[model samples]
Target: MRKVGVLVSGRGSNLQAIMDRIADGYLPLEIAVVISDKSDAYALERAQKAGIKAAAIERKACASKDDFEAKINAALTDAGCELVVLAGFMRILSANFVNKWHHKIINIHPALLPSFPGLHGQGQAVAYGVKFSGCTVHFVDEGTDSGPIILQKVVPVMDDDTEDTLADRILVQEHIAMPEALKLWAEDKLVINGRKVKVLA
Candidate 1:
């Protein structure tokens, strides 16, 4: 089984979804470690409950973003993680770090990426008035949410939908899509070519 590491900056509902899948033997992967930038993040608590190693590598503690990411890389490497999943990790990784991990790192974005790449994705979608908005799982690259897409699940954007309501809907799709992306990666079924991701049948 492939070992995976998760990075989170908040309550980690996505992280919890992954753990639930692992516990139920639905995914052929193991969560080796969980790292958070925030010391008070509830993701750490969830990791501990599952008997997984957890750490808080506060960005403020490090001298720079490079230093902070270096610490995170060390923690993941030490845990023997082969895959890194960014659940709600709030920081933008440096190019050096992105190159190091390459396609080994994956993230789930709230908006159907390429539409709303950065922060407040749900709000972006609502403001843009897109009828269909959802989540995307993609490989991490140098650019923000510009990597090769692995999977996406569309959710209808209702006329009366608030940002919070739309975000909640997309989050459910994130839970399902993230794990499916991981499974494809673990099974060596994803092929990244140029800007696209091809799943081998």
Candidate 2:
């Protein structure tokens, strides 16, 4: 099994989904460690409860962004993490850090991407009156949510849908897509070529 490190900054609902899959033997990857940028993030508790190594590498505690990411790199490297999973990790990693990890990092975004790239993607979709919105799992690159796509689950936008309501539905798909992408990665079934990701059967 490949070892992966998870980064989180919130409640860790996605982290819980992954943990559930791992517990049921559906995912072949092992969580080496979970690092949080906030000291008070609830994801740390979730990781510790699962008997995984967890740490808080607060960005504010470090002198610079480089220093903060260097500490994160050390933590992941020491834990032998082969992949980095971003689940509600609110920090925008520097280009240097992204290049260091290269395609080894993956993230789940709450929209189809190439449409709403940054924060509040679900809200953006709702505001734009799009007929459909969805969640995307993609490889992390230097750009914001502009990496090659791996997996996506579409959700139809309703006429009466508010941002919160639309976000709620998309979040469900996020839970599924993120784990599936990680599973594919663990099984070595993901192939990235330029701006595309091909999944092998």
Candidate 3:
């Protein structure tokens, strides 16, 4: 089975969904380890419960950004991780770390992307009065969320939707898009061309 490393900083609902997919034999890969910058993150707890290796590499403990990245890179590399998945991983990786993985890393963005690329994506969509909003799963590049697209799932923005409600709805799609994209990766169905990703037959 293909081995992968997962990074998380929050509750890790996405991580749980991905792992569930794997256990159900829907995702053709294995989670080698789950690393988190926050020791208290529930994602780490989830990983531990599943009998997977869980690591806590706090950001403040490191002397410098490079040092922090080196530790993280070493962890994944030593674990023989072939792919890295960012499941609500809060830290912004340095270009060196990003380039190390390059196309091997994938991230889930909470918006359609190329719009509201950073945090508070749901709030941005609500404030912007968009009638529709969604999530994007794309390859992690040096740029923020401007990487080549993998797959997207759209959710309509209800008129009375608040940030929390909109986020809840988008999260459902996130859970769907993430594992589906991983399935494509496992099948070697993703062909990156320029700024686009083509799904193979």
Candidate 4:
């Protein structure tokens, strides 16, 4: 089985989803470690509860962004992680760090990407008055949410939808989509061609 390292910065709902899938024997992989940039992030607590090795590498301790990511890379490497999943990780990674991982890193965004790229993606979609908004799982590229799209699930935007409501719905889809994407990757079924991902049957 492939080993996964999860990076998180906040509540880690997606991280929880992956853990649930693993526990239920739905995902064919092991969570080797969970790393967070914030010392006080709830994700760390979640990792501990799941009995996964967890660490907090505060970005403030590093002299530069590269240094921080280097430490993160070392931590993941030490854990024997083959895949890195970014579940609400807030930092913008440097080019060197991104290149080192290349297609090995995956991230889930709250909105159908190429639409709302950065933070508050659900709010951005709601404000823009989109009828359909959802979540996307993609390979992490140098640009913000600009990597090859792996999977996407569209959720209808209700008339009374607030940012929180929309995000909640998208989060459900993320829970499903993220694990599916990871499964595909773990099985060596995902092929990246330029900006697209081809899933081999």
TM-score of each: 0.98, 0.99, 0.99, 0.97
Predicted candidate 4 versus true structure: per-residue lDDT over 12-79, tens digit per residue: 89999899988998889999999999999999999999899999999999998878988999999999
Runs in model 4 deviating more than 4 A are none
Please give, for residues 28-136, the per-residue lDDT of candidate 1 as tens digits: 8999999999999999998998898999999999998888999999999999999889999999999999898978899999988899999999999999899999999
By the TM-score metric, which is better: model 1 or model 3?
3
lDDT of 2 by residue, 1-201 (tens): 789999999999999999999999999989999999998999999999999999999988999999999999999999999999999999999999999999999999999988898999999999999999999999999999999999899999999999999999999999898889999999999999999999999
Model 2 misplaced regions, further than 4 Å: none
Q: Give lDDT: candidate 3, residue 132.
A: 88
Candidate 3 CA-lDDT value: 0.95
Clashing pairs in 1: none
> For candidate 3, lDDT tens digit of each residue in 65-87?
89989999999999999999999
Considering lDDT, where higher is better, how would the candidates rank from best to worst? 2, 3, 4, 1
- Which runs in model 3 stand beyond 4 Å of their true positions? none
Sequence-dependent TM-score of model 4: 0.97
Number of clashes recorded per candidate: 0, 0, 0, 0
lDDT of 4 at 194: 99
